[model samples]
Target chain A: MDMATMNKLMECATFANCYPRDVVFRQGDPATHFYSVLSGYVRLFRQNSEGREADIRVCGPGDSFADELIFGGDTYEYHAQAADKAMLARYDINRVRNAAQADDGMLARAIAGSLAGQLQETMDCIANDRLNTAVQRVALYLLEQAEGQESPASFRLAFQKSLLAGKLGLAPEALSRAFATLKGLGVHVHGRIIEIEDMDALRAL
Target chain B: MDMATMNKLMECATFANCYPRDVVFRQGDPATHFYSVLSGYVRLFRQNSEGREADIRVCGPGDSFADELIFGGDTYEYHAQAADKAMLARYDINRVRNAAQADDGMLARAIAGSLAGQLQETMDCIANDRLNTAVQRVALYLLEQAEGQESPASFRLAFQKSLLAGKLGLAPEALSRAFATLKGLGVHVHGRIIEIEDMDALRAL
Candidate 1:
């Protein structure tokens, strides 16, 4: 994309703030808009028919979400939510694409690249989430969230467990059961903070 | 999408014939191209970690597949296979997008309409095949049966739970558990003399 095309696209941007846990866009919602994080974090995920959501990634400052829908669908194939207080530059998909319309090569490359990225994310979700049980999925999620924390054995749930339950393909009750099961296995959960009393035990679950 | 832009987009098209059961592209392949069916059918699906293939939807004449990844990611989200002998128009994602770059509105709207269509079909199949649980499957199975049955309130088990379980992609034990769950839902299950006491409740599932 040339500087002029890029600039024209930028001019169409609008700014907004999304509080933590606020929904940005849902899987299957029209892919009419995309966003770039100026500050804070965004959660990207896909939800299944059973209302199970699987995390795709977390986008932070300088990161973008749902931009690829321009190359792929009328609706988003995934869901996006503000993971933390966030300021975002929202771009209308058509407006940006229109801005780049003058350069066919730029548009083509963008489409291919964006679509490729979307595809991989979705395929990863299916491959990872499909074969696993609720317990297994929840366990994996706990382990992932715990990683990189100051205390590797403890961390805060990024979002409410209600949200986590949907993402993990579990009913709220099922999630509670999973927590209980993990607790029995030596993981501790009190509200949002989770502690791995026995990392090995948690992993063994 | 104006005729000029549409015509220009069509100019970039190329043709290929894919045979029945041929792997058009596997899920996770680079989203370099998408296909429009000219004749026959195309099967789209996602695979689980265990190599189980869950079908999303099948593309028939005039239907297109894989076009939505343009806005989303770097790879194909699902696998596409020729279900029957098919002649298709294959569009390189970048090439097609480039053709529309001269008119961004055309590109965006074309994308929105095409992608929106693709997702609405067989999405549930994807949910069922890729992410739904045994209980959910049973619920879905019961619903599906109700639709096919002349008298939905009461119907005989098609075969046995063992066979039914396999058909619905559940193991025998998992199938039993599913039945137990459904039983709690007020669905009557006495060795295949199945009776759905509340149709709306079953539909709610």
Candidate 2:
């Protein structure tokens, strides 16, 4: 986004706070606003009728959530909860819509860019689930986290192992086995911190 | 879309025809154009290195394919191929971009509407996969097809049973079993025609 559009949105946005584990919204709730994270983690997930919850993604500092649905969705499509004490910028949905309608489509285009990114990520997850083995999926997830869009050599796991397993669509035992298999390829997991000893070997999987 | 906006897009659009079993675009091809279906059916699919394919969705007359990516994607995200003889309205991507920028964000917002729709559908698919059983999925798929946004009591299966199986992430035998199981509940499939003999009973599942 350009500095101008970002400035405009920030001008109208309001700051809000949440305690750890506070639900921002649930699936099917009326979508009133979208938010940007200022501190801590926010988790987006889907819950089954029997009360099983599987994570979709976790947004940390400087990340945004539920913004892509501004143009077409009437309600929140999934659940959002604070993973920790968090600060956020909440933008009214109608104001954003009006701004998009008022502009020469630059803001709308920027929002579309954000939607495209999420859409790509979701589709890639689907492809991974359908195409890769359990061990391969784990390796890919680690590599993805360690080397995010802004590449880094090592990265700390921001959430719990149970949530990580849910994001990977693996059972807790299956995730453990996957990690055990990756040990042969020099991937190391020390509590919440992860590092790849042999990036090439991990990629080969 | 307003009549004026529709007229503007159609004014610059071109028409093309395809025979049965034609490839419109492969996954990762430069997304040069977005299209509207004038006639026939198109299938969107993803293929793995082992030459296995899974379907995403099928588009028929009065529907559109690959339109949502016009604003933000660089390449066709999935493969689109003709399932039957088809007529199409093809809009050049560059021109669409130019028009979107020239407008008062209305065109861009319209395109965003399309993106929102696809995003909602993709998320719903993820939710269905995470929450529903195989039989329940098949049942829901049947109900969805029968009760599309435009509700109808009976609907024809547009593509091959194998492709339908791929779309549902079911084995061919699993699909057959689902159909057999459905038969006990008064749902019937004969050739390509499907009718729900007991809508209330099917919905109870």
Give the DockQ (C-alpha) for candidate 1.
Answer: 0.12
lDDT of each: 0.68, 0.78
Q: Which residue pairs clash within candidate 2? A: none
TM values, all candidates: 0.56, 0.88
Compose the digit string of candidate 1's lDDT tens values, residues B7-107. Answer: 77688789989887788898778889878899977766677555776545557788887776555446776788876688999888787655545554556
Q: Where is model 1 more than 4 Å wrong at Cα?
A: A1-6, A20-84, A91-131, A139-157, A180-205, B1-20, B28-33, B68-77, B92-205
Question: How high is the lDDT of residue A128 in model 1?
Answer: 49
Q: Which candidate leads in DockQ?
A: 2
True contacts kept of 2: 0.41
Q: What DockQ would candidate 2 receive versus the native complex? A: 0.53
